[model samples]
Target: MDEKFLRKKSFALPKVNPFIHDLQLSMKDKLQILVMSFTLAPIRLFLIFILLIFAWLIAFISTLGLDIDSKKPVRSWRRLPILLLQPIMRAVFFCMGVIWIEQKGLPASRKEAFIYVIAPHSTFYDAVPCAIIATTVVAKQDLISAPFIGTLLKTLQPVLVVRHDPDSRKKTIQEIHRRASSQNEWPQIIVFPEGTCTNGKALITFKAGAFIPGVPVQPVLIRYPNYLDTFTWTMNGPGGLTLLWYSLCQFYIRFQVEFLPVYTPSDEEIDDPKLYAENVRFLMAQALNVPCTEHTFEDCRLMSQAKSKDLPMEAGLVEFSKLSKKLGIDINEMNEMLDEFALKSRSCKDGLMGIEEFAELLCLPITEPLKELFNLYDRDGSGKLDFREYVIGMSLLSHAAVTEKSIKIAFKVFDRNGDGTVTHDELDHVLKSVFGHDFETRNIYDKIDQENKGRITFDEFYAFVKKRPEYAKLFMTYADLEQDDMPQDKIHNITQRRASHALAGSSILSNVQYSNQGANAILKEKKDE
Candidate 1:
């Protein structure tokens, strides 16, 4: 990865913060420190865990005499230890000499219980102190048993949800309603609606659970300001304990917390929790000045897994099986069939497919589904499919959920000039490259040119995709859409191979051969080129 190439503002630069012009760690220093850091970490990790257990144990022990269901505050004497414990924990972290959390927002007003939603959950520690001040939080049942953090979380009275059980989602929501509506002293409910963590680089989709309560939401954005990426949890990078070790090496880790104004939804929005959640997620992303993505928690989970699987490999070319492995699939079942495409797709005798080889792998008479997959995966528009591109394409196709954001991003891959439109020439070039013939996509072009303008804007392209028949299997969607328009050819017979491959199936695609020049044939012969 060249830091000089196409670096977006969204990706945090690997340099020091101008405000903290201290000498950053060198690679060798980091390795040396990383090894030493963990040796000291277990003690620190254990100390923090004990601090949380004691704080909660004391708070709960003090509260036993009071009416558990009362909304009224406990006697100041009882509250004193609980309040003092939070600050003491903060001081302990500060004394540990590695991290400092700077919280800027005024605590949520106690007048009314509101939903506190946090963003940019980069590490496991992102939600800690805010969770303290915000009172209680909604969490999974497993967190209670999670080492070091579990006892502390239990003190917070986290509303826990079960996984994969019947009525689990409903049960979780009901718990939220109970806690949010309770007259008892359950602190305001805190939730990380993004449902997963990131590197503070992007804000992905938010889960809808937070909005179900239909109450005012207090949105908080958390950013780990770092010269060393203490914020990111990488796939193949050091494991959690090692990352913990690295953070322990930070002379002082600082974070920025911004509390946006409370957003009160209208009755209409309250009734539509999905709409409400999306609106809030969008607002937070805008406030953070990051591009909003349509990826969900599942997308992050799968991508993280795929990244881990490849982290051990060298930087460049990867095997076809490696590509499928990232997508969490075994392609050996289809290897016999894949061999045909691989032979044509591999640009080098090294048996690896680069972008160009993959993009232009198939011949003429391509189907809609395969064409869309190609456009989605070609990435750089250089007519190649590397390991990364291949995984993303196959993941989305296999997952069967195409987000609007993904569609918009993928559509631009075909708009070669970056002019916001896929021009006739652009489509012509792509089709010719893929099929090895200048087959006219006249009908397809006309369909995509919704305004009959001879060009396809992203909106037009998106519309064309949205209108694709959902019934068609992964790669066969478009095949069914234009079966009537396709030319008669023996090579066109491979479109439904996904079904034959059984459980470890994939998008249906076929090899194509153009046997007829036809009147509209724009294909060039070998000599013509």
Candidate 2:
């Protein structure tokens, strides 16, 4: 054999399954499959739809033929057929592979009579599960014209809705409420608050339309853990479906449904619909572990801190008006003065100092003199100043006779390492160097370390200083002088006045005299020796 001819030939590998590889199916492919399946394998769905129509028709015909009232459709005997129909609908859903519901928490009998707002992961698969669970005549105006499902859905007596028609939407809500109130049934009103669908990772902002009447909104958070790819259907990107054909072909995908605890709307929250919606949205977000745009703990803290100064101004106008009436000060004049103060105080340059340093710079102790100052700065009441709290506190301190320049210098000194905020550890170290001998360092540390994390936070430090007036007074007095602008006239006047007062009183001078009596006694004993 020739060397070239003897060389081995390679064979091409077989193609892998595209169904396993593709993340989301295209709309065109899904529709084609749905049409073909409906044409060929229409028996199960067709029989179910026919059975449901026959059952409803029989009820209608019996009421008419037997002279039974149409308005009062729920006669004792009529309930049997409706009860039988529920299982049929459930069977259809099971066959479709939509959901396998497992109930937890409070039992159905004891559940405080309320609305169950079902939120399934937005998908066409959601329809079947929603239909199975829904009790109070589930209706969707949008789904009235939907392909094979539309005729069946209409026959089921769903209230049709027109999205842009406000009047129609309002009517739908009223009708739903009426039905729910009259019929004692668990109406699983499936509403996608996002108003559109996306991959289950993100939740769109909830619209407040459904929650208006302050009905308890039970949030049912569903997760499709096993088959996420099979469940997603959108109108955008690779996963979306625009035409009717796309939905049916995509219906065979397997899914899991989790019904989270119901969220009840508060009576107090009814008037503020937006706020109510936000609360529900927040709860849903928390349950889902998704990020919520609603106000959080941190948000509230920030708002409180920001509005602290405005408190006096916002409350001051009314308070000052009352005080002015009682104190007999001109309300207009006080208001003008307040405005001026507010304007002058707008510069937060001196606001960067710590509360202790600011107090010291003004020669004010953390005693009764600084009570208002403490309250103004201690936003959370934890006692110590965080960086923001410290800054605001310094601003308040500076207003009490400490010049802006002096306040800035004092802040720079206190903020030793120059991190904007003086943390508890830095404050403690400074305190240890200054007043460690006054109290046992170990005991002081134990008291200040609230978390026992081996370091103090600003709140802890503040609490410690507040408890000891003597130490606070001494610290403040020393800190006041650290600032360069001790008034020259004040120092000179004090020195001169003290000298004149000492000269005027010989007794005062004698009290200051140092005695050498013991020294003289020792000298006499040495001479005798």
Candidate 3:
């Protein structure tokens, strides 16, 4: 499948109707009802157990009769039963196959912090674990009565958010802010910005009411690695909720949760909550790779760890010798070739070099075979190459040795305008084509695109090139090298290694892409150290 199409398909999810908001007992209502009914027996048993535990604790405290409202009494003796019951409930839920937890990145606080955004797996079953772990206050419409968990959540004073009106949203924000300001405790308010359940693929459109400005947003990703048939209540086919109830009844699945680091939206960026939600959703999606909807905070955390595990021991190594061998050339020779090309490609100060001289400077004996490739891109008779032409040219040259299609994909991307030539204005565009448009790249462009014309002219391009001659040299030399007789597996290994190295180098280059400001800063910091 085409990569773009695959990406689109992977991210697709069922859309929730806005009209459902008006209905009292909508799908969410029905799901909740089913969950309550199905778990009615267990709920009653658990309630009885809770009552017994509570009664025992109260009786024990009554014997003291020494001002039970005191902090010392509450913290020391009174809190014991609840603390003890927590693990018991967690274990019960785990055994019941109802929920699991996965913690990801380090939290800002190991003990206490206010702003917490919990993303559950979007099912009544999944909600149990999230409610248990995060102490989530469920947001419900005023029409529905609070269910068993809802009553429990209310006791925790988790924010009870109502969603039908603008006035209510504003009031909700105010209440949250007020609660946050007054709280000395760490109960987090959990909101499902996607607003509805999905198939764990595409994320729903986020409602930004809960993400107040200046508040930290901690994303949690959740994943069910087992059979969805036995684990999830939100599956598309028949036996969906039934299977969920059976699974809950039988207790037969495992779950993983990942917690990502807390992210605080900048004051300036917070005005647009939708954008804030989208950014968070995007981060979560990218971390999980299964699709935006499939990801939750827990899934992201687990995925991060999984990816970290997959990283090779030599992932960070830059083996220049191995790279040289793959290119079938001496390292020093290739460097010389690159240096010479870089010098020749330099623009004439007074336009002294004519077209023939320029051609001579650029022409290579090895470029003969590549010329056929270049000619295929020269759709226009213009002697000079454009972004599109150059991209095709490079892609053809690079395709012989690199098996990863991403290299060619990068080439095509650099030719953003679909034009046949690349101009100085498109230099950053080319860089973005290769490296992703990540934070580092954004920083690079913000600094380099000083004129802000959105395109880099030749002068700007030359300045960038001079600062990162290594990349230009590497590409030129790689393009010039002959094919090697390495085994397919070895070639794949080499390609992967090179790609990683390239990404690292590009990151370093991005830091220096603008001027030498960041480079000088680094040096200064090192000196200071």
Best by lDDT: 1
Ranked candidates (lDDT, high to low): 1, 2, 3
Off by over 4 Å in 3: 1-85, 98-103, 106-113, 128-134, 141-147, 235-241, 249-251, 292-529
Go through the candidates in order and give each one's C-alpha lDDT. Answer: 0.54, 0.43, 0.43
Model 2, range 318-352, lDDT digits (tens) per residue? 22212233334343444343343334333443322
Which runs of model 2 end up more than 4 angstroms from their true locations?
Answer: 1-73, 98-113, 131-134, 142-151, 154-157, 179-190, 237-254, 292-529
lDDT of 2 at 171: 74
lDDT of 1 by residue, 1-529 (tens): 1212112232222231111112246887678576756666556667866776677677656655554324344555766665666775675565344355566766567454367888877676665555347466777777767765565554455667764443876877877776677676656777888775555566666778888878888898887666676535633244666566666665656767787788888898899998898899889988887866544444333433333343212212222323443345444322322343345543354333553454344322444444544655555555555444444444433344445654554565467678888887777654443333557666567767867887787777777655441212322322231233444232133222321221122322211111132111212211132
What lDDT, from 0 to 1, does candidate 1 have?
0.54
| Per-prediction TM-score | 0.55, 0.40, 0.40
Question: For candidate 3, which ten residues in a row score worst on lDDT?
Answer: 311-320
